[model samples]
Target: MSTTAIGINAAIAVGAYFMTVRMIPRLRDMFIKANLAGRDLCKKDKPQIPESYGVLIGCVFLISMFLFIPIPFAFDEAAATDALTGGKPATFPHDKFVELIAALLSICCMIFLGFADDVLDLRWRHKLLLPTIATLPLLMVYYVNYNSTTVMMPNFARGVFGTSVNIGVLYYIFMGKLAVFCTNAINILAGINGLEVGQSLIIAASVTVFNFIELALGHQVESHQFSLHFMLPFLATSLALWKFNRYPSQVFVGDTYCYFAGMTFAVVGILGHFSKTLLLFFLPQILNFLYSTPQLFHFVPCPRHRLPKYDAKTDLLHISTTEFRLNELGKLGRLMVTLLRSMRLISWQELEDGRVITNNFTLINFVLFIFGPVHERVITQMLMGFQIICTLLALFIRYPLANYFYATET
Candidate 1:
């Protein structure tokens, strides 16, 4: 915290925000001109919206990293001295620069996949596996720069285990799992206009707040400051995207936005060395992921998109699920569906054609089940509101709540 450092970071954040905001229209026009729009046949009155506008975030972020942020701050004297060549000054951002490069490459890979999916319309299998590839670069970086991946136990349990419980090499596997889950969580819990980008914005803002709080508390200043570096640009660009991507959207962020936003979190978590803390902010996304796991794993028929059923007259949305015919299933299958329907876990609707309709298995549908039919925007708000509450709860639990259950690991 020097004033100079504070001023420099603030300038970079403000400048990046404005630059990205100004460029969104240009990016949207480029997508539209290139015929990059989503097929909107799934929902009522939904129009084809321009896709891959999320590339603006990557572009603006990388550009700001290079153009504004200097290589060596006052914090890099040791590096500067180590590189005391014939007056070739130390490079900026220190070792973290390498992590930035890895993050950029990984994000580019994700954006490429998203663009391919948008243009070529790849299937679920491809979507599931491609993001794993995007994470390889980031994961490799984390492996090379080794650190603790130990999960903290309760104090008494830690005494028995001789400190934090180390999961050993299995931590890499866990990181890989984190990467996959983060990439897909936001992607799975989306279909409406603002829900995708809105959640991203909220998560970014939450992380930003966490970073600032850490900085203010005089704890891990440099690391939290580094986290802010990513969070600020993300929040900046996402706010601009949200304006056009809101209800009655001018553009569709598409799979690209989800892939990009999710991986951004992955990058920040890995590079900032706060992966555990980072994961806490994503509890809602994680819960939604868990809630939808059965459908995602194909226990039930998972539709390409779990968009709510829109009522034209009421202007409200209802749950949309796959239904099975009685004749198509054996006794056990029929019994299972019957029980789930009775529990209201799955809805059963009688069709005039002697068939049945079942509610879609997703958090969006679950919200409607609890709250009854409501507008899509309301659903977005409630979910986003829940995300905010979860994030604040995470903050509370990370500190105050820890006094009872467990100690902070690092």
Candidate 2:
């Protein structure tokens, strides 16, 4: 049954990939005709590219997933039940259908929100909180279907918090927070061609790899299978988008794609019962978010766009910076900035006056600061390489070092 399902999903994914590639060119004209376009600031001419093309990918993915609704049950019902329930007494798998519905609903809500944002250009504060509303359906489904809120404690901490800690309502709150974080993390880390779609691809591939491992080991097969159902088509459509959004980009993915990609990860992680493992794949994003905190929270002056500055003469991207007087910062803020500079996390030039010129806190800018000015494409590739490295490290920790930290039944 798993094999059959896998084959079907692969077919769907391939179809989605081809469909997206074929349709994107046609849609590009429509998007531009509708005035849905943006200037690619990294290029010298700042060419106008179709924007919000992520909505197209989202639409394709949703359609593919919707078409797959019947594949699990199309086979022998008893076999499907046994597979879904891990060989428990055979019965119809109503819960699986419910989960699918809820997942679709949540993803649909996110797509709508993302499209609205592209059209309306909502405030950053609003975008940050709107994802929570989109997650309500998912949380409700989780509570009603499989509310296992307890988390395993590390061996070192077990004595203090017990072997398993049931965080109760806090677990749901945490899930909500996770959704918010996932939705925003990709959006926050985005700039340059293909970076958003590129990072998402790496994370999705990492999650898919993790799912394959779990399924092969016969560990939580149903949960992992559930994750694959959404992830495969997502990866397919995203790959198609990346081909155009890559260096020398022909179209812009816009904030819509970021939100949709983030929501897809959140849905799979939450429902697949491997939220922790899923988070491991986002290590780079987490670091980026942490690094950007001061600017995000207004401790430092943040430009509307913290994108790496393009040096047209050199045809390279340099670290983008913000200038402010040192005296303007509160003592704590000043201390924090000084500490970051001292640690080389940030680079700054003390101006002739009391003002300070400091690099904007972003992973893209940080990469340029560390590696020196390079083409936009090089920086993106470097970050994607970092993402792959993080995934490998995460997998090693999850599989090998896990036993040393926590007792588990393999």
Candidate 3:
């Protein structure tokens, strides 16, 4: 089978998976009005339909297999040429069968997990166990066909490990541990409504950009053969899932979808031979997590807990305690103050004592943003720019924008 056929097939399968998942909410509503015994199945005061929605979605993906599997595969000659000529074009693996199998396993695992989580509310232990078991075949396939050398300081210092090592016992242990970490990280981020979906967009965009860079470098064979095959399909699946996952979310992706998506990404990074690049793709989220770590450890207070939970939904760790505690001011006044505090335009103590504290924490993030990547590469520069923009926007824009929409209602 050709690379083009595989790419097209994967796209269709993912598209179908998302389209079907989107129907869950509507189905739930119907079930609830009917006074079904399963009304309790939906947890959020919102009705939940049967696990049949998952089955249906899985079926759509299954049908795509028949549609895509048979077409004669052909590589994208144009993409190959572009890559060789130092122009970026998205490319896929020459061996379509391996990718096809990986995608199929991914879809199936997602459907299974989605159904279980939606109906049963599976425990954390079980969630870990199930995905770990499912990830083995994928790990095997990845090791069999891909290189596992740790490439540090690309095009410079590098360590080459034989394919024999990749196929050995030790590689499986490392892959298993990495898979669990990534999948859980995605699940943790999926805790809030719209957060996972929003973050996924950023990740997908980054990966797509990386793929474009690889293509432009005219090294399509190296990039596409080992890496993009998995990444592209994973990105495609996430994009399709986002349709159902956006605000006023119709269907929660549940553990199933999140786990599958995370595994796909984790495996792709491992195979791509670009662990460092994967870190770059996830930079924003990593920073956010780090910023929040102090609060998690009780080193600092989280102000959102002091406010009405719904109204305080967007509060990050950086938000000050004073603004969070102020209730005498009207909602609009409170919003303006909170906005200022979040941006680090004003200190929490200043808002509390009616005087600004001279020192602040905002600059710490700014400095890290500038120096983080330790390189002058285009991607690093762009990321640094994003950090600055995010800092400014968080301080100056997001609050006002949020206030405009939520003031009266909250």
Candidate numbers sorted by TM-score from highest down: 2, 1, 3
State in Å the error of residue 305, model 2: 0.5
Which candidate number would show the highest TM-score if scored against the true structure?
2
lDDT of 2: 0.89
Per-model TM-score, in order, reads 0.86, 0.95, 0.54
Q: Pick out the ten consecutive residues of candidate 3 with the lowest summed lDDT.
A: 306-315
Q: State the weakest 10-residue window (summed lDDT) of model 1.
A: 67-76
Best by lDDT: 2
**Model 3 regions more than 4 Å off:** 1-66, 70-96, 146-171, 220-244, 287-308, 312-410
Model 1: colliding residue pairs: 71-92, 71-93, 72-92, 320-360, 321-359, 321-360
Clashes per model (N, Cα, C within 3 A): 6, 0, 8
How high a TM-score does candidate 2 get? 0.95
Residue-by-residue lDDT tens digits, candidate 1, 230-324 = 67767777787888888877777877778888888888777776778888889988888766765677655667768888887787888887865
Decide which is better by lDDT, 1 or 2. Answer: 2
The CA lDDT of each predicted structure is 0.75, 0.89, 0.48
**Candidate 3: tens digits of C-alpha lDDT, residues 1-410:** 23565467557656655655565555665534643323212123534422223244344545655465444334456555777899876565545457556746754675677567756777667766776776776676765676353322221222343212223465566566656656655555433333454555566455555655555655444444434544444455455555554544555555555555566566566555444455556555466445444333333333333211122232222221322235444565455556655775444454545543222222233333334322112222344355444544443322345343222110
